[model samples]
Target: MATPAHLNRVALRGRGARSNATGRFETYRSESFDDGWTEADEAARPLTTIIQPMKSRTIIARNDSPDIGFNASINPYRGCEHGCIYCYARPAHAYLGLSPGLDFESRLFFKPEAGRLLERELSKPGYKPQVIHIGGDTDPYQPQEKSLRVTRAVIETLARFSHPFTIITKSALITRDLDVLGPLGKAGLVRAAVSVTTLDRKLARSMEPRAATPERRIDAIRQLAAAGVPVTVMFAPSIPSLNDHEMEAVLQRAAEAGATSAGYVALRLPLEIGDLFQHWLRTDHPDRAKRVMSLVRQMRGGAVNNSEWGQRMTGEGPVAEVMNQRFLIARRKSGLDAPSQRMDVGSFKVPARAGDQLTLF
Candidate 1:
């Protein structure tokens, strides 16, 4: 297991018995193999590279989850580059025949025609307006967004139709579209939430390698607030023995930055994500890895995770309770308990096609 030079900052490397697979990388379990084993008997595989392409159809996706807020959502991209070790979205990449590890960050997908598809969907005869969520599955403003501008185009379409929507992201790039978002938000048709995991730069870098810095995200919240856009600060995926201690601090900072609401969720490792998260812990924070996993198991009811609808978001146990208490206290002290106001959909009006003729009075 050779460590990639770029990853030396984390001081970790992959080490496991390999198989003789040719097309894709495969992992095998090894339990006390015979001593003096040599590399000749190991299997070799080719590394997969990034496959960038555009999704052609169906821009809007519906959500039926009981705990989530929005019913309709849009994802401008498929995979995220902000390699957050605890990200549950990592498992989604496995469906693309890619590793949930490094491949999740390198390989990416974009919806180049998102704006056109959205316009068509909204223009349907029976189409109804709801609070459409952006970046529900992946960050709409990830690094590639600077060049692709898919998210920007989608926002433009929503604005043209006077539609309401919400956005969640850790990127400061959302500020780039304030010209479009600010007015809609002032009209009570749009809101944004910025995710701030930790104030510690080193921890942030290791946990979410490509996300905007904590300070920059704070600035984004402030900027949005100044523009009259409602901003909610999210301390999401509260990793138990890792970033939990900073929950209160994060709330305070968000409040100081003019955020009006706050929320959090315990770290979730579902499906293939469980293995990837464990591997990350053992690699980066070997010393605290055991303690962290132990606490996580306690909250997860003696396992790595619990996916039941009620228990999945916040987990269950004393540790989870303490975290909830801390979050509540901070939120209250910061005056961040304002009830979320529903965005107005009654005012929605479908725009006429560019070539459509207007009737004279």
Candidate 2:
């Protein structure tokens, strides 16, 4: 991996990745150099966020990964603007022949016709009403979601058909759609999960630059629970030395704020994410970067990451076993050890669209 250039300071401010290296399949790599002619603070500008429409033929994606919770998922957006450094979804951007570093966050794509496409798919004659997870690959309520409202549209379509769904996000922006979520919750048709990595504001700001603050995320849980939503607090990507110590505290706070259940996932750095995260760790937290990586390897069986089934989400060995024990104890103490409520799939019905013939009973 290339060193983060000084230009990164100006151009990639508030972003997680330290360097924007080319994707793995690219033909050639590029690096930055500073010539003596350029003056300091001379017309250097931050990179602008570019938004584009993604022309996707289908909306729902199916997976057979046994480790994953849901089989069917939908993503309204192609990339996330939250810029979380430990995001496992980062490597997916490489499929578009784009850098998983800065480009993954800055250059984003949204499906403008997501609501229409979902309606058509749900209207299929043999369509089965199963639990569809939203924001499975990328956050549905990223920063741009506030203005684009693509996520809200999809939710409306789901509501019309009485489809069961679940959504997970780290953004406070989700609270803005309580009007839709409140009714879904009442019908047991929807559940929400908020990802609260840590209670320390500073650490969260550095690790997940554009995401909601820890305090705001806690507040979002409070609001969702108050609105009758069955909310789950997710302490995801639990980095061993850096944020592992805060897991119990995070669950406690969420439980107090009305979270019904809690879950966690160990840090996963697959593909290019390994390089991007290491670069950020060295640049931002040089004090404990070495120690953090050492602890991670101990959990991942002497490697930085492991992709084996059943052991990937929650690693193995002594360190990981200890963490799991701690989480179980904490979950019990926090009163969040109960299983989540199952969504109502039998209530699903195909909503009539405009210009359709009325049926007489």
For residues 144-184, could you state the per-residue lDDT of candidate 1 as single tens digits? 99988999999999999999999999999999999998999
Candidate 1, run of 10 with poorest lDDT: 14-23
Question: How many residue pairs of model 1 clash at the backbone?
Answer: 0
What is the lDDT of every predicted structure here?
Answer: 0.81, 0.91
Each model's TM-score, in the order given? 0.88, 0.97
How much does candidate 1 score in TM-score?
0.88
Instruction: Report the error of model 1 at residue 81, Å.
Output: 0.8
